[model samples]
Target: MSHVTARVSEGERDRAVELVQQAYADGLLAPAELERRLERALTAVSAHELEPVVADLPDQVVHIASTGGRVTRTGDWHVPRRLRIDSEYGRVRLDLSRAHVPYSRIDIELRLAYGGGTIILPAGASANADGMRTEWGKVICKAPGRQSPGRLHVQVTGELPYGRLTIRRK
Candidate 1:
């Protein structure tokens, strides 16, 4: 009998790397351990291979629900592995300039219905919005470049049915 293996995408690999970085940042992994995990994550070919890289780290999820009011996240806040934002007739702003982003990559899911939001990343951070969808609305992305070594990666996925989503570098 043959077992099929699921292939991992670039985004998955990037997220794995991010997890390793987060562990390192949190002092849970030594330099050698971090290096090893990073190497493994970058070379991982399947989802199963990425699991061990972050198995020892803590997992966190942030949820923001807005109703006709401004919701902002900024200043020394801890960046979670997953962030879910739901907005209706309001705005959301995420500023990562001085925030502590332990993960090298962060996944943000947004559901914008008649609302808008903005994501402000640090200088070396990169964002991928290919997985996001906008209908009857607009998404403006202004960044310096793509992800590279020693840079953070943000993967934006979700739907914007009737609002705007802006991602910029600060």
Candidate 2:
């Protein structure tokens, strides 16, 4: 019999170990398989796994600095992963595209004004915001989501009725 010490709470650890024993007694797992599964379960139940899950999530509605990670929403109309700012000849356009990020969860903030605009996102794979105004156009953005354990695609676009257009992502 080997002893395993995991940083999980006592009850959780005991429960996982019990499950392993049950698996073994049922002949569903070999000794080595039981040990491996126990270790994996203990890690899965550890508190440390919860920290980075929210580390890159934004806490407010306004963006200050860029977090430079990435965000993947499982749905649509999401806040963008990159803050986009465009200024030319006194006209500006802000595009917020947080769609198609790779992570399971994220938080971000963005605002567009002086013709600027902001988007509150839910989750999706892409985004676009464009409008026509007389004097000024604005574009605002939020921090990116974390790219820790997956791949994400982000595409941003800015176009004018008679001037220029840009497409970008990192």
93: Cα error in model 1, Å: 1.5
Question: Candidate 1 lDDT, tens digit per residue, 1-170?
Answer: 99898998986786677677777887889999988889888888888888877777776778888888988999999888799988888888999888998666788999888988899999889998888888898888887547888788888888898888999988
Superposed Cα deviation of residue 29, candidate 1 (Å): 5.6
TM-score of each: 0.75, 0.22
Provide backbone clash counts, one per model. 2, 20
lDDT of 2 by residue, 23-136 (tens): 576577778886766666566655464233223323232233223322212333444333344332232223334344333332222221222223343333232333323234
Model 2 gets an lDDT of: 0.38
lDDT over C-alpha atoms for residue 150 of model 1: 76
Please identify model 1 stretches exceeding 4 Å from their true place: 1-3, 24-44, 52-57
| TM-score of structure candidate 1 | 0.75
When summed lDDT is taken over every stretch of 10 residues in candidate 1, the lowest stretch is: 14-23
